[model samples]
Target: MEEFVPSAAIAHFVMKVKDVESSYAFYQGLGLRGIDKFPEMAIIELRGGTHLLLAAKDDPMAGALHASRVGQRPDFISEKIDLMIAGHTRADLEKYRAELMANGYSPADIAEAPLYGHDYFSMLDPDGHGVSVYTSHCGDKPV
Candidate 1:
């Protein structure tokens, strides 16, 4: 038997949104660049090489796409998905949180978690997906 290995890295993540335009605007507000627009989908480029595809849930193509996946399609709008982004330092995380707040994003109060060994904050997108920005470790604390 041979070990299975993936041929390539993940190029993008597809999020089935109730409204593509609203989701696109929400991500754009978070600083993601809109690369392309389609009738029922919008492509957004994040900081890294990965991209985010916001597709309208009711699009005809959505059914075909969901069928190809292993499990039932997730309800992205109301799902509890934690999209975490790493920050270089505590100050960096703090700055990001502040920026979101300044830009009309109401992120929850920052919290320190001993179990995770990090300080993090979370905010909800327009579709209600949870996005978290966190430092790997609490200041001077071991993971």
Candidate 2:
């Protein structure tokens, strides 16, 4: 059997948003830097390292750029894309978790997942991207 692996894996992700301005503004509030902006789309780069593309619904080429709307696509929003980021400690997880909640993003219960022995919290972005912060314990707890 032959298998192929991409050198860098995912290059970036493009998300279709109803309003680029609103989506750009939301990510900006989260400390992301806007790298590109057009009438139909806006690109925001996060501090931790990831690119976010906000594509306006009216964009003539929007359909070609995005997949089927998952969450609150055209109207209401839901968390469809679950993005997990790494945290080393509970404090690290709490820090981002609280910041997100205070900023209007509701974080689900912070709990330990037995499968991986990690503590995690989750939230959603403007376009319904599921973002999560987690601390992996690998079964060992802080003493």
Candidate 3:
């Protein structure tokens, strides 16, 4: 057998949301692209060139696929996933966090960690997915 070589990469991350529409709106407000084709799935494009797939719990086709094919349990959807975003400085993250708070979402517990530098706060989207806003000051490097 020969080793497989890669050409390019495409990735999709799925998170379970109790209400797809609400989550869609939430992510959309965070400057994420693509929100119209929702309810089936809410897709958010991150600043770091990644995609987020917010899957609704009440979606029938999702249930069918998971149940019939994936052999997943009825409740096998994760409530959250840590999404890493990039910014140049702590102030940059703070500006965005303020926008998030103004939109009625609490960007909680700004903290500086040993691994990552002077970053602050995280927000739970309508679906309870944690969106982390970090800057490159407190830690040696961004993880």
Q: Please name the candidate that would achieve the greatest lDDT relative to the true structure.
A: 1
In candidate 1, what are the lDDT values of residues 54-77, reduced to their tens digit?
A: 878789976765666577445433
How many clashing residue pairs appear in each of the predictions shown? 0, 3, 5
Candidate 2: deviation at residue 66, Å?
4.1
Candidate 2 lDDT tens digits, 1-143:
55553345343567767778888887776546888888898988753456777877668877766554455355634434434434566677778777876887677878756226556766666667766656644333221
Candidate 1 has an lDDT of 0.70
Local distance difference test scores for all models = 0.70, 0.65, 0.64
Superposition TM-score, candidate 3 onto the true structure? 0.68
lDDT of 3 by residue, 1-143 (tens): 55554455445666668887778777788777863455487677765446777777668767643444354455654545554445666567777777777888777856755234445566677655567655654233323
C-alpha displacement of 113 in model 1, angstroms? 2.7
Q: How many backbone clashes does candidate 3 have?
A: 5
Candidate number with greatest TM-score: 1
Indicate the worst ten consecutive residues by lDDT in candidate 3. Answer: 134-143
Candidate 1 displacement at residue 125 in angstroms: 1.4
